[model samples]
Target: MKKKAFKEILKYVRVIVFFAVITILVEAVNYVMVQPGYARYIIHTVDNPDDGSDYDCIVVGASHGRASIDPHYFLEMEYAVNPINMCIQGATVIDNYYMIREACNNNDVKKIILELDYQYWNKNLKRDSDFGDLLVYGQLPFTSLKMEYIVSQLMDKDFRTIYFRRYAFAKNWKTAKKYMAIKKTDEYKNFQIEGVAGIETEGPYQGLGFFYRTKVTDKKGKLNPSPWTYDDLNPKVQKYFQKIVKYCKDNGIELICVTTPIPPSSVVSGAANEADTYFKQICDENNVRYIDGNLIKNEILNVSDDDFSDWEGHMNGELAEQFSEILTEILMKEDNSEYFYSGYDECIEAIKVRGNETKVLKYIRAAVFIAVIAGLVKCIDFAMMPSGYIRYIIHAAGNPGTEEGYDCIILGASHGRSSINPKHMIKSGYAKNPLSLCIPGESVVNSYYILKEACRNNAVKKVVLEMDYQYWTNDEARDSEFGDLFEYVQLPMSKVKLEYIRDELIDKDFRTVYFKKLAYTSDFSKVKYNIKTKLTKEYRDYDISAVKVCDANGPYMGRGFFYRENNNDHKCDFLVQEWTEDDISRKVIKYFQKIVDYCKDNHIEMVCITEPITPTAVVKGPSRDANTFFKDICSNNNVRYIDFTLLKNDVFDITDNDFCDWEGHMYGEAAERFSGIMSEVLANGNEEYFYDSYKAKIDEIERKKS
Candidate 1:
């Protein structure tokens, strides 16, 4: 009795262990998959944040600081101070405070040059900015600072958006996107050799650390000046401004707030002037040094109205060159003493550890503990709630040995899934065990990828392709069940899945990669089905007798097809629908050719069969074009093409009653008959027993037709 009780307890323990392991793996994978776009400079700064890394004198602020200061200038001209322009676009004073604190921690810093852009003070300092703080977030290693910042933002700002990678990357998404998209191109490959980080010295950006916007006007063409006043100082920002002073003073880092040189029009308009006066007052109160660019804009910087194009100084590289030298001189003069460099490796290790560091995973064990209790008490369901289709996908992912290999493979959309019964194909002595690799809404592109996925584990020799008539023209195949979910989530995570995401899926939904386990649940039916089914094995059973899988969410695909089962009981007409060639995608034709080529190259015999469509549904031009296209591709590739679209015989005659619904997928009996016709054709020969004539009475039907 004790032994039995021990065994029962062990079962429960094992289940708990499974839950913990699965949850951690999901969270960890998601965290890695969503590692915000890695930029070269950002990575170097984060990884080598020490004296050895040569990032000694750090400059921090918004676009003005970024464009105004050049680290390479200091590295080449001064050789005393090593710096990186740590300024990002739209950076606020509050942003600078945290940045300063992090930089001090990460490097053995001598001084931090702060950009006192007055307009930045207008922003509410207590909140996070819409600007790309994610660049900093992605750059910073996991540290107390990062956690504190995350917590503070969560408490004060948009709580969920704080941890959201998409929201954080909103501003720079275009840059990151372009960088990723061109990754495979020869141009991109050649570009990578030039190095991703450093000064932009070649193109329009003739200077390091900034883009030199050519002066369009003497100061007027694109001279857009901001409407600012001294009284417009955001009170919350004033408070944080003082906090930065205290932090810098206490940390023994000399902080110099500088008002950068801009166009004469901005100063004349009272916006830049009034802000400058206010900054001096704040600097005087904090006992910090303040540099006035307006007083010395002409003398030291050598700038004129013609050179000053815009308020942001998007005009002269000469101004940047001169201004960066002055800033470096100011740092060189401040105390004239260098900081003691220690913890070179340690600082970088800490930053690297902190930047991509996450504590969310550490709590998984505890979460599972709480979750186990809750699950037992019906408090909340675990992520274990997967749809029937998801269940099949998850099962297909690990792919036990029983499912790895195959003799015959059926691939297509609902028409083929419902039409080609795998069991009938085997029972009729056509092939051995055949797995129906069909999903609803699959286009030609989707099928090609799905077929590739099947070929990974299965040693497939014969491919029974259900050539959807619409696929010939329509490249955009959406599944009747989960739409694009099966196109991705159903397949195990692999390079093929990533390729689907990168090349095919137009939206580039990262959630499919990051929140993979829950990505499909965003849709209504799938969410509801997952909740109802709880990813139960019973609802996701591979019916051994039928040689098909039943996905609860994929109602039609349960019979190993991608559509719901029916017996011609419910049939409704749509408002207006007919097959048309106007919407045909040339990509569909290309994919068909690709599929045939893949089969031939891999030594697999391909049999292309366009399953029967309802007589009423077929439009003459559209249907004929689809059939011709399918036939042409198959013939060009030496694959036997069977056109069952004209199944107008006695036994294989498809009536309105044969269809399951308006979509034209046939009922069980019709599906069985279609499968029988397919099997007999392959078993004997396409020319002899394949046409619309039934195999049992082919002679009589042929005579009648003659």
Candidate 2:
């Protein structure tokens, strides 16, 4: 019996150990994945006071208090209050109560200002699922109170969400890359939030927990108030509010409840009066002050729906400042009834929603109208967008491993597309099957994604990267042009595409991504043509001829090549793009390295090459620097560097006459010949066909031609 009992205990111990390890791993991943955001910043600010000064008053509530309360205003107006705003977005009464406790624990708080939004007091609402709640919970100091809070609030949430906080956020490989980089920083480790706070649409997060919202309501007077009744006051919320009151009383802290101003349109016809009466009676019972901003007449606080950021009545930054000033003035005065109406009915009579917008049918009609408008806008955006070469190339690539996948793929900008012929390479017995995935105006970063796109479908054994010095630029104007946007927009929806967007295009103007027409100036005359073309079966199937215009220089050739007609008599006056160490973009280096690394990881051979350019006047230092830069990169990565400009004139006789223009985009005949030569060299792995130096080749050509 004793031996059996011991064995049972051992079994339980083993199970516990297994779970402990799993729990540790889950927590570790959570630590890394959950980025340092506003919650961490705000909590750190209040919990660990930088000034080491006691706050005279601290505001605790949800987003309304966070945006509306400006503690600096009180200081500026010579009020004897040193305040900290501890309001959080989507914070419930429970969150507020804990925030109050946290503030009081850290510093000597003389008073508490609680902002009330009756919508948050709904009994049916589940607070655990809120990302805001999880963020705050994750940032809270590990204490008995925290444990209790976790048991009360977070126990019912998904274990993944509780342990791996990023589960609550949009989980993607790209977002992981972003946050992983963030995790490596000293700022993140030190819990610093100074430089990185707020988003593009939202204004900056001012210190002391105030968020200045820059966006105003576009809806104007058309607002949907969160309809609430007096009975909607949650029992749990009341319990916490009462706890906050009792805690404040025991600590000898003055408690003042204030309802931050909302647009009159957000106030349901009679709901405001119900909330006002209930809050007033409760505050009166607790012997605390209750001031409702909704009761403030239109004369003193002249605000409309325009002052708000949303229909829910979150004030914009400008309105917050104005309201803060008024709030400070009221706090200074002993009796502030002059600024406010006697009751909610009087306030509603003065400021009300325009027209009969409160009806249910009106709301339904408005929603339907907005939906229709959105759909029409999307249609217009789509119609105005032109079909570019990228769509053709991607479509031509076909699905993964389609029809005995190509072993070789060429990737780069237009030079590769126009110069190298996959057909000629195959004819010369170089590669069994190959595809040129090159795009016009493609950046090094874009080339990496193109390779990824190619590899996903085909069994890629080799990648030939065409180096264009002009495309290796850090300038946002140079890299994120319409061509780049076109390439991104055309890629099929896949993991690779999503990762590319998250990693590369997340920061680009969203309008450009969603509405491709916005990135380029559309010729209004072609609108009818474009819309008609897009509607065709050819366009839908990505027929190259459907979109391609047969210009003088070239016609669209299948397998991602544009066959250019030779212009032997064309003048060459354009300068050769000079490259220097100083001019080298870090973005170019990063993406180039990524390509090299990817090739290595996948066991695919990557060859770096520069296509022949017209030997125009060379800017002395940059020519040599360009050769050195590329050579060093290839050598460091143990890859071959082939500079076609350094090809021996005897081996491949090409001139300015062979190219369509000064950029050295080969005409069809010359391109075919070069492709044959490329195939021979690549098949034989011969370096003797090329000169040792770029400058030497340029000088020899210039000397011979002269």
TM-score of each: 0.42, 0.52
Show where candidate 1 strays beyond 4 Å. Answer: 1-385, 393-404, 474-485, 498-502, 505-507, 516-570, 574-582, 619-621, 686-706
Worst 10 residues of 2 by lDDT: 615-624
lDDT of 1: 0.60
Candidates in order have lDDT scores of 0.60, 0.76
Report lDDT (Cα) of residue 373, candidate 1.
57
- Model 1: per-residue Cα lDDT at residue 568: 38
* TM-score computed on alpha carbons, candidate 1: 0.42
Clashes of 1: 15
* Residue lDDT tens for model 2, 411-510: 9887898888887767767677889988767888888888888887788888888887777655667564564566777788899889987886665665
State in Å the error of residue 411, model 1: 0.6
Show pairs that collide, candidate 2.
400-457, 401-457
